[model samples]
Target: MNPGDRASWNQTANADFVLVGLFGETKPATFLYMVTFIFFLLALAGNTLLIVLIRVQPRLRTPMDFFISQLSLMYLMYISMTVPKMLVGQVTGDRAISASCCGVQMFFSLNLNGEKCFLLAAMASNPYTAICRHLHYTLLMSQRVCECLLSGCWLLGMSDGFLLTPIIMSVPFSQSRKIPSFFCETPALLKLSCADISLYRTFMYVCCVLMLLIPIVVILSSYASILRLIHRMNSAEGQRKAFATCSFQLILGLFFFGAAVYTYMLPTSYHTAEKDIMIPAFYTIITPVLNPLIYNFRNKDFTGALRSTMQLGLSPRKAGNGRA
Candidate 1:
């Protein structure tokens, strides 16, 4: 095979890879299966409820809520990428995944992760518009604008997936086919490759910086501006409200983006295969639960919205869409 033929390398080189470990859907632990099933149910319930509330509750409609709904949708898709696989493996104990399927899985997981980063940045922009330019916010963030932002998020996510998956899959995995974790991810899949991946590792770092760091900077800047409004306000109620919104945005960024940057941006020297499994598991499986909790708890308005919508019971009345 010619060293320069990337296509041929990708087509023929991945046969050695066979997924194992973390349950293959044949005969998994019963207790583990139940627990994973419960988590899957929670993720589905929480994200689906959030989306429904955003849609059915007329009062919950706004640019921020729009973004939150998008986030919930992303959470649903994101969790589906891995949790179902885990659930299936638990029920059947069949952990076998082909190399092509592994590439596809990593592509989607990474794609949704990128979509999330962009969505969070868009979420940050909402409060900044509300606080920094209160009057013009409605104009600035009209439906068309929000639609554009969302479309851009998906486009960028697809680009991230398209750019990285093939390259990573092309790496020569000459020996073990068994991946260390439940799902195929960039770091773990790269680990299976026999060839030196220094160049790709560097590329991963750059992508991490772009995907993880840049959004964080955007979030911080938005919060910084919002915090100014909080401090300047003499009314305790107004200050608290401003602070609450800022805190949620900051927490969301820190929890999700921070974890990603630490996992992906840091040098390969710092990572262990065992440790890598834990982070992805937390963010992928655990964070979906946390996303709803964060919005519900840290932002009191969401709790109030939920209560209001529950009371209305899908009446679809043009009332009680009251501001939180």
Candidate 2:
């Protein structure tokens, strides 16, 4: 039962974990490889550019973009938690991962997911201050306050992972080590355990609801207030601008949270592993890529900066001047 003994460890399912990635059909592994490679490239490219633009382009140095920069950073970490290992799987055709490594992957993925949720809520507050309290927006979202928000997000997210990781890790996965899902999610990993995890399921569902629902509720309420403020505005240009800024973020929050809630909040009796593998990939891969795409495509400030950066072929000094 000692974890370090590889020979004896190989005799038990608990010592090693196998990941059943997205492609479970007759299609070549290259098909999934190509598809994942494209998305990985897109996610990397999109988020990296957004972060650089926000950092280098003075035009993007605003209250919203500050939080967006953090979000982009989280997206990068979020994708990193899963994608590289997946690419390795594609190349080696070896889905085997050490149990300890599986634990590490699960912990970070959950941690980043929690961080992302908090970032979305913090972002919602940005727009609420913008449209609802235009005069006070700058004063309210000061450097100190932004730092505080960012710090709190990291702390809250780390606490969620810290609390959940140990509890889930303590479960005995003696029955199986093969996880049907692409990544090491709480639900999927729980399914591998031999003991009765009904209580654990209930515990996780509660955690999921509290962490996911509260942030989403705050986001929704903020948007509703934003909409009301925008509606009362007499300037059509300002109204359109306000709506444009928050719309993509709102869409992103809803889709990621909705899918996450459906996947994690439901009781185990309701769904099977066969149905679970398909769900996380969409949120994990597709949503991250969409964040930058939505911003670059729709937000004029972002697109303008992007265009200018392209025009200058990414001259850092000129772009940072806010007029490339």
Compare the candidates by lDDT and give the number of the best one.
2
Per-residue accuracy of model 1 over 17-62 as CA lDDT, tens digit each: 4444343334545666687678889989998988988888777778
TM-score, cand. 2 vs. native: 0.88
Cα lDDT tens digits, model 2, 159-203, are 778878889987777545888877788888887776688888888
TM-score of each: 0.86, 0.88
Worst 10 residues of 2 by lDDT: 1-10
User: Per-model C-alpha lDDT, please?
Assistant: 0.78, 0.82
Poorly placed runs, candidate 2 (over 4 Å): 1-14, 310-324
lDDT of 2 at 87: 80
Off by over 4 Å in 1: 1-33, 297-324
